[model samples]
Target: MCIYNNADPNSGIQSGGVYWAYGPHNLSNQFGNHFVMNNQYDGAWVELCTGYNGTGKGESIISAGYGFVEDLSPINSIALGTGNNYPCSPP
Candidate 1:
């Protein structure tokens, strides 16, 4: 996943990667709407969480090959995986 500091998605400071998984990957001090690029392959997906370490409520699901400009203010973490059992929100 590539997170952009700008909402335009076309250009901005880009960060993040495909290596992070089952993480609380806390976005400290990050605010406003940003562009998130989900580059995961093989049907893998990403989940945005409200709490740290894959806890709390699940916010949104970013499927592979999809990208969106989302508000990062309420999102505290992210989880990457495939299948029904999500690492951020179980069951």
Candidate 2:
């Protein structure tokens, strides 16, 4: 799974770019920004980002690369908003 936080000054991440992210257990809700990406076995990715990162639904998920299960918290699996420059260029 990938997450691109355009305005994330802490991670120094840029927009229009894809990144693989893991559990954000300690992610802060200041301004309510953060993301949790899940790489399913179907070669597809599931991304969840929300205002508190669903602290209540915090659970563990098994990573693809490593069989180890990492702590994961499910958030607003809904797409609250979309980027303006969507319909991205063909990869």
Candidate 3:
């Protein structure tokens, strides 16, 4: 999910470039505040950027599993990689 500001992909704010992300977790520091997911991908990684039109410092791999970012930290520009590779069975 590529997050964009002003509802324009050309003006991206951040990205959730991963398979799936759940829960209330912070991505990392160096990212802008939450706005809207301008784009979403099903079978690919979401590329994150610090600015619009793919600008700013980029982090390709944010996580690899059901990952979570540091607590109380600034949200990162993007989160990458697949998720739920290993699902937990019923308790």
Candidate 4:
């Protein structure tokens, strides 16, 4: 279990100081991804995306109140409070 801070748009692939938890060194592992809801913002959503900076179509959005415990081996990046960007809401 790892905790990633808020991601910075400037950092691109290396955003959020989360590299240590989700960096290239650890991303290749076949471990399943898990995310817990720690955000206080109402209606906030966490997203697991295939691209950096939380931009792309193949994104899995986790709602503000839910947690993710799935095989996210294919995802490379994550973000919080990015629900407005994606057309589909978190499932």
Candidate maximizing lDDT: 1
List all candidate RMSDs to the true structure: 2.5, 13.6, 11.6, 9.3
lDDT of each residue in 7-75, candidate 2, tens digit only: 233553325323344333223322234343333443432323332432333232323332222222334
Q: Number of clashes in model 2?
A: 0
Please give the lDDT score for candidate 2. 0.30
Model 3, 1-91: lDDT tens per residue? 4333433445544444322453222344433333334133454334344433333444333332212232212224343334542121111
Clashing pairs in 4: none
Question: TM-score of each candidate?
Answer: 0.82, 0.21, 0.26, 0.50
Compared with the true structure, what per-residue lDDT tens digits does model 4 show for residues 1-91?
2333213223222233232222122233333434433333466655665655554444566665564444556665565553376532243
Q: How big is the positional error of residue 36 in model 2, measured in Å on the Cα after superposition?
A: 7.1
The alpha-carbon root-mean-square deviation between model 4 and the true structure, to one decimal in Å, is 9.3
- State the C-alpha lDDT per candidate: 0.74, 0.30, 0.35, 0.44
Model 1: residues with Cα > 4 Å off, grouped in runs: 13-24
Better of 2 and 4 by TM-score: 4
> Among these predicted structures, which one has the highest TM-score?
1
Query: Where does the lowest 10-residue lDDT sum fall in candidate 2?
Result: 82-91
Indicate the worst ten consecutive residues by lDDT in candidate 4. 17-26
Task: State which candidate, 3 or 4, has the greater lDDT.
Answer: 4
